[model samples]
Target chain A: MSQVEELKSELTEKLGSDIQIKTEFGDDVLEISKDKVFEATEHFKSTGRYDFLMDVCSVDRQEREKRFDVVYHFYSSKDNRRLRMKAQLGENEKIKSITPIWKGANWFEREAYDMMGIQFEGHPYLKRLLTHHEFVGHPLRKDYDSNRQQHCSKAADLHFEDDETYVPDPNKDLIPLNIGPSHPATHGTLRIMAQLDGETIHRSNVELGFLHRCFEKMAETHEYNQIIPYTDRLNYCSAPMNNVGFCKTVERMLGVEIPPKAQAIRIILCELSRVIDHIVCIGANAVDLGALTSFFYLFNMRERVYSLFEKLCGARLTVSMTRVGGMANNPPEGWFDDVLETVATLRKGVDEIDRMLTNNKIWIERTKGVGGISSEEAIAFGFTGPCLRATGVNLDLRKANPYYGYDQLDFDVPYGTSGDVYDRYLVRIEEMKQSLKIVEQVAKNVPGGDFSIRDKDIVLPEKKDVYGNIEGLMNHFMLVIKGLQPPVGDIYDATEAANGELGFYLVSDGSKRPYRLKVRPPCFAIYQSFTQLINGGLLSDVISILGSLNVIAGELDR
Target chain B: MSTVPTVTRDLHAESEDLLTTAAYTTRFDKLVAWGRKNSLWPLPYGTACCGIELMSVMGPKYDLARFGAEVVRFSPRQSDLLVVAGTITEKMAPVLVHIYEQMLEPKYVLSMGACASSGGFYRAYHVLQGIDKVIPVDVYVPGCPPTPEAVLDGVMLLQKMIESNQPRPWKDNWKGPTQ
Candidate 1:
């Protein structure tokens, strides 16, 4: 038997007949009773496989007897296998907190509580996460009104309950400092409340929801194609990746395969996006450390990438460039030439930045050995992407899972020994070069043909054909009126985004719009460990650490 | 005796001209307004994607420094213009208002991007429909995260408003939007 099958049978025997086992979208799913959740999860963790808790979220089925399905996704770096466990609960029913087993589940559980109103019984500080403390209703619930507005009388009334008295240690003379929610260095809309002993931080807590645009809530009302624009706003730095990941999920449910040319174009766009994402991460990190020159150098290259995206999709930052079963459009004439020119310019800029920052004594002193986490702690906290790789874990989804023919491309996954701020910087810098290489290769080997699937239901006919041919006109009218309908099932699709694994867990009820859509943002997992990473570090190091993580508020609060 | 009489006449005439020029004062006002318009130090209240575009405006290509408004002061007290960029959620609305109130007199507010101008595409619960709901805005630049050039244009519009001596809502008895 295969590793997944062997594990599946073993889990079925161990968890009793109450568990229901099924395979959908090539993933093993275990539907367990609510009471046995903690026991089964603990058993799964103790087996030394499934070491990483990839994601934890809840899907609301308002009409069902059990109104919520709390889903848990786990990955085994040892055997490169993925397992999903879901426990169903009725309204007002409580589930045991998984934070005790995986510390990273803390935020996920709080988010579930905040969005769905499902309570986690033993979760410490199970309060509002992505909404204001005064927000009345759980937003992701199907019955929740999309247009309801909740207003606060004053900013003073917006304090967490624990903010009144909680302290890391009552004995120590620690000064409380409020870092942001508006400060420039905190990036978007993140607030850090830190307790400090002298200049060193004792403990810190992050406050999110400042930029919460309610993307998930918005996704419910939008059709599959209409939701593509909303996905662009998530992880806006690498927008094409979000577009592709969401499209791939829906396409998988529909079981439509995109043409080869479309896939190749997608590879180019995604890699270009990865390069842009790393530019922002590294450039912003360097700028936080008082190295402004590198930011200018890298941003010039980013501007070039934006121009390329503009040529492709007519917009720069929020490029909603992908469609289900294919891309929005074919590449314009001489697109390959533009890609090569941009990559060449980017290489020159990267070389210049390398000469200036790499091995610089001051940069090393500020970054090396600071805010470090061990591999064991990183895995437990569910760190992925470059941050986990910096701790010497070779768990890249692009290589292991090989989605979208990434296995056909040639690249290297750079890793580091010490998971410090410096190591993350190095990993991102190397990753940028590798992405550039991928873009170059894809640009050369890009196939020629249709940029979308041939199916009439899935792809819109050409405007000329629609205008002339009666059959084409009929097909166009039907598509415009009734959208593409996927099969009634659930699937989870993940892409190797610049930050890490960007997964989209989609549930369809044989409708044009999705029944439920959940995004497992890489930054959401990384930000949960922020307090641990910054604890005991100097106040200034917090900026460096946050920059290294590259936590975009759009994704974090979505 | 003849030279002395001529000097006395010239002194009396020159004193009369000086007094009239000082009393009129339109030229002095215009000069002061011109200086204020050119040397506008903006405090960028950059909160989201529009903030990135604002940064690009300051970069070498667009070169906001060429317009003489490149001195971006983080502190409200030091700035004469407030460039509110990106969406303002309810949680952040009070902070924006507080920053606006802290600015020195003769300050201008440039609402850059659709979000800051009118909450763009994010017309949902958490988002404050428009930043104008909290503080008065002098110029509204319309774009979903407007391009750097658009932001620069907004800055220019603010400079023109300052020169024209447009009546600021804050300067009047205008209370902000009611909840």
Candidate 2:
């Protein structure tokens, strides 16, 4: 038997007849009783099979007898396989929290609780994750109104006590400092509440939801294709990746295959986006360290990438450039030339930055040996993408599960041994070089063919054809009036986003609009470990650590 | 003695003529307005994507320094103009209001993007519909995340407003335009 099948049979035998095996949207899904979930998860983890908790989310099906499905996604690095486990719950039923097995489930559970009103029984601090403290209703519930406003009278009332277990010592002279929600060092809308005892931080608590634009709530109301624009705002730094990720997820549900040219174009756009995201991450992180000169050198290259994106699509920052079966449009004339030129400029600029800051005494002193995490801790916390790789985990989804012909592309995954802030910096810099290499290869071998799928139902006909031919007109009318409808099933599609694994947990009910859409933001996972990382460090190191994580507020609070 | 008096009188008349020309050369209001317009220390309240565009405006290419607004201050007390760059969520609205109130008198606000101006496309519950609901905005730049050039244009428009409007003392009964 194949590894997945063996594992499935083993899990079924271990969990008994209560577990049922099924496949939906080309993913292996196991349905388990709610009570057996914790035991099964422990067995799976302790057996040295599945070590990574890729994502944990809950979907609400209001009309069903079992109203909620608490979905858990697991990946096994040893077998190079992924598994989905679901536990059903009725209206007020609570499931055990998996935080003990995987600490990364802390925030994801909180998010599920916050959005869908699903209660995780053993979650230590089960509070609202991405909504205002006084938010009235669960926004992601099927019956909740999207237009309902929940307002609080005063901002002071919005501050909730953080993890009430830790009481401050009255003997120690701890001074409270509020860092952000608007401060330049905190980047985007993140507020850090730190209690310091003479420049050394005694304890720090992170406050999020300041940039929550209700994206998931908005996604439910939008059509399958209409939701592309909303994905762009999820991780605005690498928007095309989110766009392509969403499109790929819906396409996976539809079981449609895109053409070769579209795949090549998708690779170019996603890699370019990776370069841009890294530039912003590294540049902004440097600025936080008082190395402002590197920011200019890097931002110039970022602008070039943005211009290339502009050339490819109309928008620069929010490039909703991908559609369901393919891209919005083919690359314009000489687009490859523009991409190559940008790649060359990016290489020169990155090298210049490398020389300027890589071995700089100040840079090393500030970043080295700070915010270091071991591989085991990283895995337990569910770190992915560059941050996980920086711990020498080698857990890149692009390599482990190749999609869109990523296996054919020539590139290297750079990792760090120490997992320090400096190592993350090195990893990102190296990754930028690798991304540029991918861009060069993809640009060289871009195939010449249809940019979108030939299926009339999936893609709208050309404007000229629609204007002239009756069949073309009919197809256009059908597509425009009623959007693409995928099969009735749920699928979890994840891509190696610049920050980490950005997964879309989509549930479609054979309708134009999705029944439920959940975004498993990588930054959300990374930010959960922030308090532990910065607990004993100096107050200034907080900025360095936060920057190194590259936590974009758009994704974190989405 | 009579001829000496006439020569002294002519000298006094010439001095008086120089004094009158100097008075006409620079009006007090115009001088104050020019100083305020030329040296606008903008407190960049950049919160989101528009914040990046605002940074681009300050970069070497756009060169905000050319307009004498190079000194982008973080402290509201030091700043004369408030450039609200990105979205203001419900949680952030009070902080924004406090910052606006902390700015020194003769202040101007340039709402830098769609979010800042009118909450743009994010008309959801969390996002504040428009910053104008909380604080007064002088100029509103219209773009989802307006280009750097558009932001520069907004800055120039604020300068024009400063130059045209008379800078009456705060003690005077002249109130600025209310939201």
* Model number with the top DockQ: 1
- DockQ value for model 1: 0.43
Interface RMSD of each: 1.5, 2.2
- Model 2 has a clash total of 0
Kindly list the per-residue Cα lDDT of model 2 for residues B1-179, writing each as its tens digit: 11111112334344656544333345567677778888999888877778877877887678799999989778889998899988888777877887877988978888988888887777676788888877777888998788888888988887887787744343244343132
Q: After superposition, how far is residue A301 of candidate 1 from its true place, in Å?
A: 1.3
Model 2: per-residue Cα lDDT over A1-558, one tens digit each: 976578678877887765567777667788889999998899988997888887888888888999999999988888676789998999888899999888988988988898889989888889886777777778788888876656644444323246444444557647767787768788848888888888988777788888888888778888877788788888888889999899999888888889999999999999988988988899999999999888878878878887888888777788888888898887889999988988898899989999999999999999999999998998888888888889998878889889889898888899999899999999999999999999999998889999999688788887888999999999999988888888888898888999988899898888888888888888888888898999989998999999999988888887
Off by over 4 Å in 1: A2-5, A156-173, B1-26, B169-173
How well is each residue in A1-558 modelled by candidate 1, as lDDT tens digits?
976567667867887665567888888888888888887889878887788898889999888999999999987877777788899999989999989988989999999999999899888789888777678989888888766768755553323335755644556657778777767688748888888889998777788888887788778788888899889878878889899999998888888888889898888989898888888888888888999888777778888988998898788888887888798788889999999988999888887877888899989999999889999998888889999999999889889888778899999999999999999989988988899999899898888888988678787787888999999999999987888788888888888888898999998898878888999999999998888889889999999999999998888887
Q: CA lDDT of A192 in candidate 2? A: 86
- C-alpha lDDT of candidate 2 relative to the true structure: 0.83
